[model samples]
Target: MTEPKNLEVCGSVMDGIAEKGSALESPSKKQPTEYTVYPVRWVVLFIFVLYSASNSLQWIQYSIIQDAVVKYYGVSSIVVYWTSMVYMITYIPLIFPASWLLDKAGLRVTTIIGAFGTCAGSWLKVFSVPQDMFWLGFTGQTVVAIAQVFILNVPPRLAAVWFGADQVSSACSVGVFGNQLGVAVGFFLPPMLVRAQGTIEEIGADFQLMFYIVAAFTSVLFVLILLFFKAAPPTPPSAAADLGSNLDSNFLQSIKKLLTNRNYVLLLISYGLNVGVFYAISTLLNQLVLTYYPGANEDAGRIGLVIVVAGMTGSVVCGLILDKTHRFKETTLAVYAASVVGMIIFTFTLDCGIIAVVYLSSILLGFFMTGYLPVGFEFASEVTYPEPEGTTSGILNAVVQIFGIVLTLTYEWMLSNISDRWSNLTLCAILALGTVITACIRSDLRRQAAQNKG
Candidate 1:
């Protein structure tokens, strides 16, 4: 018996993915010689990317244009905050059941709900964009938030189902790319489209138009999903896919095992803190930027865009590194430390009132911070191998949402009651603690170890 290696070769990356025949088989008893990798996996992944991107676009759409939402709805900024934070709040409760559906019901079934739910929520918001429709808008937003629970944790599971061992981290990164790209677009587009200046009706009309655009986009993707999607490849992509899921006793049991994992628990804490701070900063980004330079609403949106765009590049780089090196702990720690440094620089430079320096700092901050997202996902799934990726990622994400809610509220409170400097400093301290926690996590690399076993 031996571990798997890609002895078979194909021409291009696409060809390799399309016909990774013998590479699908581990040189051990775990994988059968006859197993094959399918081309349709890319099609499935493509649709999933669009589905998740659309859902995530909604999460930040109202946030980037916070002041506009406040003025348009005749509500408080905190009220506008809920428009974004509701996704986090709603995600915590619903992720468990959604992950269960992913683990039990499989891919096609899970996405069916996510796609339609997103479409329905988008259309609902289109109707709710009037000043008198804030209530309807909130309900519709909550519906979109609920749909996220079905989509958020599917990335890692999707990778495990559709990709080869050599491709897991990279595949997961693409899955994550869809999400961050949507956020990037969300941050960039809203401020350009909607404005706080203008008559209430004019502003409301812009908001309505944006919602309709998202609804139409999601509707098209929904139909495409129905046209083309698959539960899994005809054959498992790797030995893990061939055998791992069969070992999942049940969702409850998977959750129990995940909780017992010391490394994964540390990852949960670190990942939550890292992502939570990003969420906090993202949700009230306008306020943070406005603190130093007032009337820079468009600049704030651009800053958010740059951050996510930088993070997208960082995630791809990180994923490729992981694929080649398989150095999860080293890669994660380096990126995490860089992110902490970036945050510190941004905290001080923010008040400097120099847009260029702030943009530079934001790039550094977003590059590592957002890039850290897929690192945490792949690492968690790696350590908790065979626990079911959906369940592992779901619990991790739930913690992220919990922390997002807490940190956003806390940051908002401190921004209001205390001073901006102190508020920013506090979050920097928490992120440093998270980095320390990451340092303490042992690199058992259990999943890789299992793969290496012969």
Candidate 2:
């Protein structure tokens, strides 16, 4: 047996583990140092995605059964709406701090904190099941909203760390899809559990069951994350990961560097608009449908499910395309264009009372709107390479939160004073603007080339 020597290549430490017959040796002796897929990486990502889903399950739980919650708790519509809006509001102030924590302490610590916060919030909501305890529910929502800042900001970082460059976009898409799927579940589950036209007592009992279901799920995920989630793989997964492992820039410096990226700034604006509109629509879907098509109030959950399911499909497809082509700019522009078209159709058709048109428009709108999320997240990471993924993603999400709050309030005002049609028009206009902004963004490939040349 030989004592293998260590070498540093391209700033990465290659040790004796790369030698032949070593425990870490590749199956092919000829390429002992080549990276191979780590099965545990997928397991960790799966758990995190489930955590992401659980976090979102709580966010829109009340929104799906908005009327029942309002009547059951005797709270006004605005108070119930705040349950979801609070998630956006809390993320604005806390995202930067969460990013800092992720950068300073690494993924394990950051995610456990998120899981614990979510678990505590879920348990709190369980206690709030008593009628007339709307304030307790609100308090629990506030805590969970804060926890979302931790969970939502980590997908891009997770993809970057756990996946090879070839799989980064797809990996991110899957992670994001988990969150979207959770929203879909939230939309569908609440209505099934709590009937729209149920009596106050029945509604209260169903709501309690919903809380218990969500609480039990959250508790299980928290325990799983605590027991099995590792910080990262022992070996770097890809060149990006290898590079990321060596970068030790402070949080302030990371933010400063990201701000200087013009492409990222453009993405921030466009992605923020896209996400803002999605949040607004998600939060108000029931109200929008019921206000216009009184006969369709019962179908609100089905409509929501259709939109999100379409969006989930789009996310996965778009991710695969980006992974294969690495065409961030083109894919983004196309999605934005599709979103504009879909939003225009939705604006025109939603109030027409034509079920088929409404469903079609909703599917298209959801597909393009929600599909753009993972693309934008991955694109931001690509352009801002070597910067902490959490920092770039955190800023992007914080921007989305700010936009979400503004847009949600604006939509609410419009619905009250104007008409649902005008609110839909407002969203369409924003999507069109997002398309224009996306068109102007320099491709990540071009930016990388420029950086390399410089």
Candidate 3:
């Protein structure tokens, strides 16, 4: 037999997946002699993209609710932190399991479940009781976290299985684009809703109202999934559409292999740290400005929207650049460095001019921050070789969520006790650390590619 360059790519993994219907073989594999790369399934892609949209509401809405919850509910910063942190906390632990579920159940099933979780969480936000609202928000975020976990893992995984090697980068790019679009819509939607109804407090009787709005939109997206979502065609040249195996030895085995991969392990650390910094900044963002500038509470909502919108724009542009160049590592490192620069400037100069410092730093930070995810996803997908596409992506996604947990905890502590500048400074330091880690692993990644080619 030909030497298996990538052990994960063996024909056997496909067999194991065959037993699991969700791991259906590629339709192209059915016609190897006629194998030409098929065009991407744009319709199903759109539906999945829509399904993925709910996550943006889960993540970005934190900024919107941060001030609202703090003011109206009399909730402490710590509790408010939990509202957002709970999602990452629940999500990090369950990512491996969620990945397993997706492989066993497939993207369509996984995405719908995820969407419902997000929608449920949003609906729960409608209650008037502040304390109850906190828990409800937590529960809601947790559900959305699960939804995000699936959406994050599945799209790139599907792209790998469905698209040709030449097109994989582009497919990955499109998925990231969808993710950004969701974020943009999520951020923009809140302000519009607020405008339609005067006074932030009266806007639908609290945060729950906003949740309802988001939930309704997500339900619509879920229906879109039902209208058009298909698993990739099954394996073997001429076998009936076999669902992949219910038992996924590949999931665990793939995780083990990935954990052992030095480059991948480093990427996980760097990616996690980078992600941690972003979330850390996002979760405490309103408080950060309030601490340094003071009396900026009213404008916090507007500022939050600006950061998210800028981040969304950055993510899309970065995705396009990555798609064209395939210079994944360099692009990621540059973004990390840019974040560090932005954070440093913003943290030190905040007192000088609040609006100018905040706006400039946020735009820079948002630009770099949003791109980290897709870069990490692309790198993980490329490194995972022949593992079930989504499985590796899920593992990588899960690892980053772990960092998110640590960062979120740190954020809670900082907001409770430290000055905003200190917190921002700490985040800056973390991003700087990530940049160093990325530097260490850069050469190794290049070496691995050369070895693989050889």
Candidate 4:
């Protein structure tokens, strides 16, 4: 058995991090080292994808059927809405602890926390649903949301550890794909399962059944992860990944270094803007649709499903392009620009009195908006190289959660007080700013540069 060793590194990438135009110095020359891409990496990635999806499904589960949840539970709309809001609320504070745990305990332990939380929460919801205990269900939702703080930070670190440089971005995209797919399920499945027009007893039974199914699936996954998930591969997959293992794992130190990096700071703001708006739209989609076209809660869920599906396609396409071109800045900017354009078109067309057009517009809005997620993750990893991916990625997730809470509340408030047109138009303006910020990012492909060294 041989130990994994980091070969010679390009010290220049670390030196030029905070300074623009000051990092062109070639990697200190060193002999190339052979790295292997293990077949088991795919198995690990598949398991991670499943894990991510399981947790993300809960995020929009209540939001997609907000009206029904309120009716069945005899609760206020806000209480029903809190089922989804809790994810952002809990993630904001817990991501730091989750990241520290990832740094110290590794992926297997993190997966356990996520899986167990999800399983326990699902069972708790099942227990609460029969009696119409809204508070208990909310507690269950809170527990699962805490699990997400751990789940969301896994992709970049997992990709860096298990994939070669050529495939890392695509691998990251696939990891995020499960989460988007799970959201897609949440959007559609509830509508099919729990009929809003049914009697209260019937709907409550439906809710109980839904929770039981989720609990069964999560319990099985918890067992699978316990049996199979490994912390790391036997050897490194690429030079950058090899060196990344040696990067500083100190939580505060990683945060300090990432904050000082100019490009990463810009990305943090831009990513927050992009994701925060997505959260707001997702949270209020049912209401937004109902405002214009009454009795269209199901349509809202389907439209959200369409958006997530399109975004899943966009993520893979963009990931392949990044792998081929190594053009993180261009891809991110293009996606951000498309998201702006999509939002503008969606804002005006949503009230066109045609559901078909609304669905079409949702595809466009979702394709770029959702697609931008993994791109932002990969880009952050690139710009903040040598910073432990777990720590750096944790900060990114935390900022987005903060923004998600603020933007979700703000947009929902505007919808209640003002008009839909103004609220959406406001989002368009914020997205445009994010696009410009994406354009201004100094293309410091530090991680990629490290891989291409002599």
Candidate 5:
């Protein structure tokens, strides 16, 4: 019966009068309008999926066809591995500037440039199709890796801009799923495209065809993005859209704010460890599988396919759960714990010579490992709200790259100098450490929810 709290707080008589007029307006005039949902946003997301897939396709291209690549190029296994490592290496130095571009220029301009880089890199690989052009392939990979710096950091930003609050995490899962799907396809397709065993000339010819096929696909996606992708919706789709104080902050100010956020910093460390380990394992998956089960060397692609499929499915499911419950901290910790168990089981079964056990363990490992990605990205955005999503995600990815480089190099050394079992056990230890860190995180979302209720 008394004045509503919000109306009582009005500071001026004029403001109170305006509030009363609005509150007492005719019922017909005051009727709430139905919020119109745009379908064009999905079209834009599909284009982004293609762009994300193209960026990742090039990353594992050589790794999937490792033996043939080493033979055709006459390089050592170490050199062959660097073709993939270059992607992580390039990201570390470039992510900050890339984040600045995303925040300053907006998503459309950033993604268009990223698409062009992807197309250019794909075509550049075609020139390296000759048996003598290994260096050229590496050069092309460098360019593509740079393109990845732009595209990979945009998913959280994309979700924040296009999706409603209830749907942000699910939307982000789809974007992350696209990259993982690309890696899955990369693993499955290359083995079939390039023969298991081949003469240098034959291998070169097969690789030439493969490059052309990928480049053509990337070119089509680039055209699509240029023509249709919009930076954001015509109207804001979520309350968070109005909360971006950091968007107008200069590059240094944005960086400083993110670094000072306790929740964001903790997530950066924990998330970096999880993803860095994934990158290292993904790059070295062929070597690990072949070492443990020599007979299954030809089946590496199948192993990768199973792992990725399980991970991609888990990502979507986890995303849905987060959206429904907003239990960011609990969800992340559970997956990290499950992943450690999965990896421990996988490590023990690796050389047991039971092929079925190995495959099951691989799928479990993939499901838990890959599923955590979207949750981590979304959690970081929540804690760092109003800070540009691009900056936060970019920093997380850059840290992951740094960890990936170190872990990859360390694993490579361990495989050469120690037993495969010991190397994997060390990784299990790292995963356990990540889980501990994840458990300690205090969810900023929980605090915000409490405030809203009050």
Candidate 6:
């Protein structure tokens, strides 16, 4: 064959080999079937939805129990912030290691370990936890973060493989929707639970009740993962290495390879800025409401509920467009644009009008913010040759978190030291960072396409 034809033939053969290998390594015999009627896939998705809910429920408690944790622990709001910040910081470094471990350990063990750790940490919160409880919570959050990586990162790739390109975005969207719904429920449920409790023991019991419920639900997911979820069919010992051939690029090698690729680096920068901008706002919604209404913690929580609800709604819309159009680049751009404008409006106007702005801005931000995650994952999966799905995800997610921490801390500090008059400048600076990175990424992708065509 000619060079172009030869390359095409080689590519075809590689595709065939990958597909067969994927089938053999898949744990589920039923996989390699099809998304349309795959019983196993649905079961997996359902179980993961519950698991996601359990994971997300903790965020609600973070907002709701902020006061209680502050009083009980004799700490400041920043300390409670560290309670979360620690988890976020720990998760970044662990991403690659966790991904590597997932490759070695398989999804089952990693997920189970995460679930159990989360359950233990959550249940410990029911009573008077020791000073060491911070460590316990930290450990649990680490495990939970690991679990979330698998839960968030793995299924869509599997779905893409099983369902073909046509359905990947939709499948990813649905799974993500499940996660956001969990967030919505978490935001809405806690205040009602707190209100229902009559006394100190009753309040303690209520938290315990929430803890056990989450644990039980996650345990069920653990069972499902053990019983049905498979990376691929069984491979012989000799072929096992080949099973991860696409992922064969080790963590360090993958980082080197990705960094060398201009598009990948641009993507990293863009995703990191996106995370920094969105998380800075999401983490501070409680404070924002209190800032405005004064003693409106409950309202802040409710607004959180509204924000998540709008985000969930926006996710559905964005997912449909992205999946149907396959316009990954444009979709991200649109979301970022909406976010920048929203931040500007909210920062400048700071009135009852700003409440509506906050509501709309938060919802759009959540929608666009989370909307990028699956797409970004899909892009990484497409660009990277093979099995390092977890590793690539780890790298991307870690960068986002690292930048996110800096942005979050700086924003919090700015709010503390400066006036609300400064919100616009801080937000605009972050948004400008995002827009520039995204623009560079878009330019690089265009260059790559041109080079390939030439």
Scored against the true structure, residue 276 in model 2 reaches a CA lDDT of 94
RMSD to truth, every model: 4.5, 5.7, 6.3, 5.1, 7.4, 6.9
Quote each prediction's TM-score: 0.93, 0.90, 0.80, 0.93, 0.90, 0.79
* Residue 10, candidate 2: C-alpha displacement in angstroms: 17
The residue ranges of model 6 lying beyond 4 angstroms of the native Cα positions read 1-37, 127-152, 195-203, 233-251, 353-357, 442-454
What TM-score does candidate 3 get on C-alpha atoms?
A: 0.80
**Model 2 lDDT per residue over 298-382, tens place:** 5788888888889999999998998677677788899989998988888898767687788888898889888888888877876
* Worst-scoring 10-residue span by lDDT in model 3: 7-16
In terms of TM-score, which candidate is stronger, 4 or 5?
4
lDDT of the candidates, in the order given: 0.82, 0.78, 0.61, 0.82, 0.77, 0.56
Error of 2 at 200 (Å): 1.9
Q: What is the C-alpha lDDT profile of model 1 across 1-454, one tens digit per residue?
A: 2233351211001111111121333334454543455677788888998899899988888878888887888888888889889999999989989988877777788899999999999899889876888898888889989999988888887887777777778888989999998898889888988977878878977887788889999999999988898777655665555555445347788889899999999999999999999999999899989878788989999999999999999999998998888888899999999988999998899988688899999999999999999989888877787577788889999999999999999999999999988998998999899999999999867666555441
Residue pairs whose backbone atoms clash in candidate 1: none
lDDT of 5 at 354: 76
lDDT of 3 by residue, 32-132 (tens): 22222333356666676666766765675655445555555566757766766666766677788888887677666776777677667666665533544
State the displacement of the C-alpha of residue 120, model 3, in Å, after optimal TM-score superposition. 2.9
lDDT of 6 by residue, 116-208 (tens): 655665555543345335555545544555455544444443443333233445555666667677767766666556532255456556556
Which whole-number lDDT from 0 to 100 does residue 104 have in model 4? Answer: 78
Ranking by TM-score: 1, 4, 2, 5, 3, 6
Backbone clash numbers for all candidates listed: 0, 0, 16, 0, 0, 10
For model 5, how does the per-residue alpha-carbon lDDT over 1-454 read when each residue is reduced to its tens digit?
1111121110000000000011122323333222123677788888898889988978888987787787788889888888889999999999999998887777898999998998998889999987778888889888988999988888887876666555667888899988998888888788878875777677778898899999999999998998999876554443234333212456788789989988878888889888888887888888888876764545788888888889999999998888777777888899999989988998899898877888899999999998888888878876765567788889999988899989999988998899889998999999999998887888776323421322
Which 10 consecutive positions of candidate 6 have the poorest summed lDDT? 8-17
